[model samples]
Target: MKVLVLGGDGYCGWPTSLHLSDAGHEVVIVDNCVRRQIDHELATQSLTPITDMKQRVKAWQEVSGQTIAVEFGDLLDWEFISDVVRRHQPDAIVHFAEQRAAPYSMIDRRHAVYTQHNNVVGNLNVLFAIQEFVPECHLVKLGTMGEYGQPNIDIEEGYIEIEHNGRKDVLPYPKQPGSWYHLSKVHDSHNIAFACRIWGMRATDLNQGVVYGTVTPQTERDPRLINRFDYEEVFGTVLNRFCIQAAIGHPLTVYGKGGQIRGFLDIRDTVRCIELAVENPAEFGEFRVFNQFTEEFSVNQLAEMVVEAAGKLGFEARIDNIPNPRVEKEEHYYNAKRTKLLDLGLQPHYLGDSLLDSLLNIALEYRDRIDPDVVMPSVDWREGRAKQRVHKAPAQPSASL
Candidate 1:
């Protein structure tokens, strides 16, 4: 199958591109390299040194003998996306190109507007290009679990069957998106579903959870092919941040009650899930949704796991109960259904002590590169309030376990 991975230079996109190529699919990656520019704007870089697109593609070819074609352009540009789609005429286009940080979206009014504009416009352009160029192309859009935002009721996959006044109807799941970034995703879902209904386009919206860990089978082939590991407050997931804190002897910063439960999956499983979605596409005129996560964990539970894992490595990690910056439920009912991917032959890589240990080891190796400044919460969810910045203290020696 010919596949095009948008945002192919990103943390997840890079490895997924290589994985797809390695699996004998003709792969083409389209990216604007805006993520690298964001790293520059934020003054923070990935914990793992990432290669440029040419270098990354070259490394993958050297390691796996599979070539991945690359195209550089902004997804919002209709001409660029349409040209790529027309040229490639791919069977599937995996969309991961977006400004994906919740905190970044909440940083300021300017950022919020930018996040919404960039993400929403980019997605709309992709849909238009697909419609214009390749009507049969399957769009595997990367939606977020955050779109469903901790509703009290058990979350269904994409849609819910509700009966009201002797009438039964199925509708897309109710969205309670927390941040502008997530709101953009919710908008994308509506647009995609509408397109499918009206234009007979096919799409799969993978409502993915918080992804952790770094290396994948294809990325592990070469040092240059390594995926990005972000441990900063804005971009990092809780588990990844915890592991990095443990590595550098910083206290595991738990926000508020630290009982915010969320679904999670390893990086390896993320790529596998994408593969499953690519292989089994949605029927024409159908917009399928899959909850793409293996398991669930709260912020406190993740901090505890990191502490225990660090203990085995002779680090007595401590937990700090910091005030929650985001206006979200610290504790909430979160029962999300995620059986679709599993049924589609997804063998999950569950979170374990060994996995945490391995991540900690990577952090330790890159410990010197960590900026210490980027490790804590800086963006406040509250509007019109001053941004609170926490600086990472010097790493203390591990106490005797």
Candidate 2:
């Protein structure tokens, strides 16, 4: 199968591209290196350096003997995107292009606007281009678990069947995203669902969660193939932040009472989920939504787990109760049914201490790369705040796109 992997230079995208290509499917990865550019602008680099896009493709070719093509350009450009669809005529298109950091989305007006335009327009263009070029091609889009933000009810996969009075209706799952980034993803889902109905296209929106860990069998420690690891507040995820903090001997800053809970996944599982979606193509005119996650954990539970894991390393993990930067629920009910992916044969990789230890070993290599100043609560989601995070993240992953 021929596949096009968008945002292929990202943390998940790169590994995913390699995973698919290694499976003997012809793959082409398209990325503008916008994340690297944004990180440079923000003066915050990944904990480890990533090679240039061209070099990465070359390395993968040498390593796997796979000729995964490379393209460097923005997906927001309609013509450029359309031309890729016209040229590649791929069997499937994996759309991972978007601004994905919640804090970065809330950083300032500029970042917020970029997140809106880049995510919405990118997904829309992909829909339009695919509709015009390869109507039969399946579009595997990355939506976010944050879209169903701590709802009072149990979240179902994609759609919900409502029995109001005596009437019954099945519709897209309700969304209440906390940040602009997640909101943009919700908008992307809406646009694609609308387009799929109108254009008779195939699209799968994987509502994935905050992903952690960074190793896959395809890679060992090639800096060129090293996944983009963001440790700063702007792009660092909660678990990743906690793990890096412990590695650097910094106190894990738990905002509020630390009872906030959400679904989480390993980066390896993220790649597998994408592959599962690609292998099981959604039918034409179908807006299939799958809740993608291995398991759920509260913020405090994750913090405690990290602290305990640090103790194994002969390190004293301390906690600092910092005031919440973002205005979100300190605690809420989060039970999402994710049997679809499992039905499609998705093998999940749960978070264990061994996994945490493996991640810690990686973080230790770049311990000096961490800027302790950037780990604190620097951004607030509310309007008009003095402590809003200043850095802007490019965009990221089945995700807040």
Candidate 3:
């Protein structure tokens, strides 16, 4: 299949592009390098170094001898995006191109607006680009689990049947986004669904959970091919951050009661899910939504898991309870339905100690690069900078603020 991958430089996008290219597909990736710019803005580098775009393509070519095309342009621009669709006429387009960080979205008013404008406008541009050219092509968008928040109901994939009084109707699931970034995702879903219904477009909204791990089977084979791993407070996911913390002998920063439960997918499974979505395209005028997660655990549970994983490798690790920076339920009930992907033959690479160990071993290689100050939560979700309150723990150095 011919494939076009947007946001190909992103955390998940880079690996997905390689995976598809390796699987005998003609793949073309597009990125604006916002991620690199963000790293520049924050002065935080990825925990695991990634090859520059040119070098990555060169390495992939050497290994597979298959050319993965790349076009560096702002997909948010209608002309640039539509021209690609017309030129490539790809069978499928994977949309992992959005403002993905929750905390980064909440950093300030300017950051919040950037999240809203960039996410929504870029998504709208993609929809229009598809409608204009390659209307038969499939669009697999990477939505987030945070769009549902911690609702007190079994979170369906993307729709729910609510029977209030005698009226029974099935509707898109209620959106209770917790942060500005999540809100943008909700808006994207609305716009995508509308375009799918009105203009007859194929779209799949994969409500993905927090992804973890740095090394996949393909990545483990070549150090140069290791997927992007960011451990700073801004770009890092919870488990990735924990791995860095444990490797550097820093106490795991547990916010509030550390009971915030969320679904999780291994980096390998994330790519697998994307492959399945692309292989089985959604029908025109049908917006398919799948909860793309295989496991569920709380923040504390993940911290404990990381600690144990690192301990097996002879690393001393500990957790430090700290005040939660984000305005969210530290403790909540979270039961989400995620059978759609499994029904599509998504055999999950569940988070095992072996996998966690592999992820940590990669982190251990860059232990010297682990900035102790960058591991803790910095971008609090609240309106003000409430996360910077200095409180020492046991007369010792506190976790990063």
Please name the candidate that would achieve the greatest lDDT relative to the true structure. 1
lDDT, each prediction: 0.89, 0.85, 0.85
Show pairs that collide, candidate 2.
379-389
Worst 10 residues of 2 by lDDT: 392-401
Model 1 per-residue lDDT tens digits across residues 279-334? 99999999999999999999999999888888899979999999898999998999
Q: Judged by lDDT relative to the true structure, which candidate is superior, 1 or 3?
A: 1
lDDT of 2 by residue, 34-108 (tens): 888778656678887778788888888787778889888888778898999899999999988787888778876
Q: For each of the candidates, give the backbone clash count.
A: 0, 1, 0
Q: How close is every model to the real structure, measured as TM-score?
A: 0.96, 0.95, 0.94
lDDT for model 3: 0.85
Off by over 4 Å in 3: 384-401
Q: How close is candidate 3 to the true structure, as a TM-score?
A: 0.94
In order of TM-score, best first, we have 1, 2, 3
Q: Looking at candidate 2, what is the lDDT of residue 83? A: 94
